[model samples]
Target: MRRKLTLKDVSRESGLSTFTVSRALAGAEGVSKESREAVLRVAEEMGYVPNLAAQKLRGVASSTIAVITAGTSNAYYLDMMNGIQAVAQDMDQTVVLTDIAIGGVYDIGRERQTIQRLLEGRVGGVISTLTLLPESVKRLEDWEIPIVFVDSSPPEELPYVPSVTTDNYNASLLVGAHLQSHAFQDWLLLVYPPIWSSRKERERGLRDAAAKAGATIEVVEAGNNAASASKALRDCLGRRGGRLPDILIAGNNPILLGAFQVARERNTIIPDNMAMVCFDDFPFAPYLDPPVTVLNERSEEIGRLSAHMLTEIMSAQIEARKAGKPAAPIYTNEHQLQVPVDLVVRRSCGCPDPTRSRS
Candidate 1:
């Protein structure tokens, strides 16, 4: 194959230093607008690509952000990644996504090595949805790199690292209100024990809503995954005859899947037999025999907003460096962002029969 056109070629052809070419390509300052455009135009004509490894040797940031996720297999995370990629692409920035594998087995060592390598290499910043160990977070704090948390645990005291997430509490309350208005009497709020912060906030919303309406609510612990949720549902159903829950609220998509499995096995017809509402609106929710009712948590918007915050932090750091000021430390902000929860009224929650509902 012909040798790949390199950044050196662009510098030589444009009569600008390689540093100016790098900054112009990376959208960083220090190059005039005209010079930046000229460099880009020549680089495009020359088909020039920067050698990332060589760029690192020159002590330049890779203009890349690392996103560490719990797992890329999850639909929610996948959506989030798409949002992040969309924004990064618009800015002509590159991303490196590292999966923090399930069960924490593949995460610990990999994260440590990855962070060390990034510090030694060319990554500009990191945006993470993985729960960094306390010590690791502290180490990263000391490194002075711009780090933003995306839907993960936030430190109690720090007030700099920004995060964006749904208003889980309000969303749960919305679900609770939907069921209450539907005349659901006895309800079960089923969630996993090792709950994420988002789920915990949702549970609070559910409880608060139920309390307001005097709805009798019972809490059931369902382990993550469909099988465990199915088992938990069965156990709950086995308790009493007329005491069966009129509606079941599943905390997340996995739990909702389990609930569906139990409903199918028990030959339970939705709405007529029992009502159901899920937190994470699964893609197939609308196609079910009785389409699912849900509080549509906008995971993509959450990702986009979090990525925006990360971009803000990175820009600030760049500005600080240009001003010869020390970079700020990573810290969690108490600011809560509220993304509206959509109530997708569907057949599962007894789609209103217009004649009867109006009458």
Candidate 2:
């Protein structure tokens, strides 16, 4: 069997002292930049994997960061994961992916078990895309395990939990303004319940803009899945007595896809029948029959910032422990980061075709 590389091997290969190699690999400040670079390069080349278990047992921070998602199926979450993995790789930290049902049914037992397992595995920190319950947050606090939320805000009861999220309110406002400019008066917003902070903020913004534009906005509670969205849309259309709204706004990619399916089944042509817009610029948005207009939430940036914030918090805690000081939660009012979203105009919202030129 091939032998695993160790820190001693890296030290020998780089011709550096074992202490220097150790400190450099641990990202300690005492090591010179030149020495650290050389050590890291040699360690990479030699495939030197640190013994994270040993580190954890020694009461030092483990080199693993846990990234929690609602599920693994969505392309939106996949994009965010890509950004998170990139930052984790650059920092020489390992990432562990975990899932907990956040927007779905609230299973307190399952969530508690998941948290306990992560703690048992000695994960140094967490970046959660789901809004954990207040009890769950307290469990993590008890363990002193720092967590940074991505794509979702912490529950209102746990305001101290730091989060990286998009300005969904502003994004929705942009969409509302665009619709009003195009003279779309009647609006139908298909969205999940307000349990999700992003959806809540978006609904608020859209409602505000609708009021100002003298447009009537009707909101339907569609769950955050394709099947649920399709059912909700079909039910709404069936009960509307053949009166379709001027525009349809889907809250997310899955909801958009569901609505699209129902529209196709009912032979409802986009834009020509009812103009459409949605949040989340998924990869296939441009390839649809009438390419969809969307608000790009910059999900990748949210992931990157969340991971970076957790790393910073962990580093501070580590430094404090080393200095023989008590470690406290690092996230405060200043830690809440809101990334901006971009409006990607496309044909679905009555925009000009991208492939055509105007006279």
lDDT (0 to 1) per candidate = 0.71, 0.82
Q: Residues 1-359, candidate 2, lDDT per residue (tens digit)?
A: 13456778998899999999988877888999999999989976764555545755735444789887774555689889888888899888889887775444335576777876675565788888778878667756655678888878998998889999888888889989999998888999999766567778889999999998999999999767778889998899889976778999998887888898988997888898999999877888889889999999888887888888888888898888789876665777878989888899999998898776888
All candidates' TM-scores?
Answer: 0.72, 0.80
| After superposition, candidate 1 runs with Cα above 4 Å error | 1-62, 71-73, 101-122, 239-243, 329-336, 353-359
Error of 1 at 189 (Å): 1.9
lDDT of 1: 0.71
lDDT of 1 by residue, 18-42 (tens): 8898899878988999999999899
lDDT of 2 at 350: 88
Candidate 2 local Cα displacement, residue 24, angstroms: 40
